[model samples]
Target: MDDIQPADIRLMRNEGSLRDFLRLQMTNGKARNAPAKPPPPPQPSDHTPGAWPTGSRPPRPIPQAPPGAWEAALHRLHTDTQTGTRCECPGCDPTTGSHPDAA
Candidate 1:
């Protein structure tokens, strides 16, 4: 029988083919009938409290857009209307030089 290392078993598990590999190993007398040992639990860290368990820093808060964003957008829209760029709605084509809202 070929010598199979524990690392090979771990590799098979990581590759998501452990079940089929284990069956083949059993058939070939390379593996025992006993169940495999489970992986060890994650160790706790003594770093910053409320931080992520993986030792990575917590995510920063998303910054809010400027308070005048909507006002600035509206101002741009008003400027566009004053530039004779008529709205391209069904009957408001600017090429015809006629505006649906014009009296």
Candidate 2:
């Protein structure tokens, strides 16, 4: 018996022949039928105002008082509240541990 050689094969380049080959292949099945992949999970919206979603604590607000400037801060606290230079005003509490005279 004689075996067919590579030289005996010829490539059909005609559109009709190519289309017929594709149609036959489709009817039979794919050479390697791949499973349909699931869609990816939706990502979270990153528009949050703070770092609450990062599994860490959010940052604190900035303090109005500056370090080593107690006198200047007292002046600012006094002026911002429209009080005179004295820290003894009824509404100005320089050490109450709360926002001063914001009323």
Candidate 3:
């Protein structure tokens, strides 16, 4: 009675009994205590950004050719001064088929 206020009286429609108010409070309390619904499982899509898939290694950092071939051609021109375009690394870096250290 002392806890009841004028606003509570208005909520009770001024005609409902105290039992009705208590029932309403109990209903609200139960609603608040109800377990929240679990979040939906992850949607099937491409890998999650940078997250790695299980039992899988990170992606290999493959060397990508530049947008243009000029740099590559220039590199061959400068480094293969003697072999020209014949330098194939381990094949003929010095125009020798054997490893430089082996010789």
Best by lDDT: 1
How well does each candidate superpose onto the true structure, as a TM-score?
0.27, 0.21, 0.30
User: Per-residue lDDT for 1-103 in model 3, tens only?
Assistant: 3487878878777676767778978898899899999998896576576777756887799888877565456435434544444444543333233434334
Instruction: Please report how far candidate 2 places residue 51 from its true position, in Å.
Output: 12
Clashes of each: 0, 0, 0
| Model 3 lDDT at residue 19 | 75
Candidate-wise lDDT, in order: 0.63, 0.54, 0.62
Tens digits of per-residue lDDT for model 2, 1-103: 1453444323433334656655776765663476667998775776465447767776889877667588556545653344334555455545553334454
Question: Candidate 1, which segments miss by more than 4 Å at Cα?
Answer: 1-34, 41-55, 74-103
In model 1, state the lDDT of residue 79. Answer: 23
Candidate 3 Cα deviation (angstroms), residue 3: 5.5
Model 1, range 1-103, lDDT digits (tens) per residue?
A: 3788999889989999989977876776744565789998765656455666664667899998898776545444442256655254454433334556664
lDDT comparing candidate 3 with the true structure: 0.62
Best first by TM-score, ranked = 3, 1, 2
Query: What ranges in model 2 sit over 4 Å off?
Result: 1-28, 47-103
User: Candidate 3: misplaced stretches above 4 Å?
Assistant: 1-14, 46-103
Better of 1 and 3 by TM-score: 3
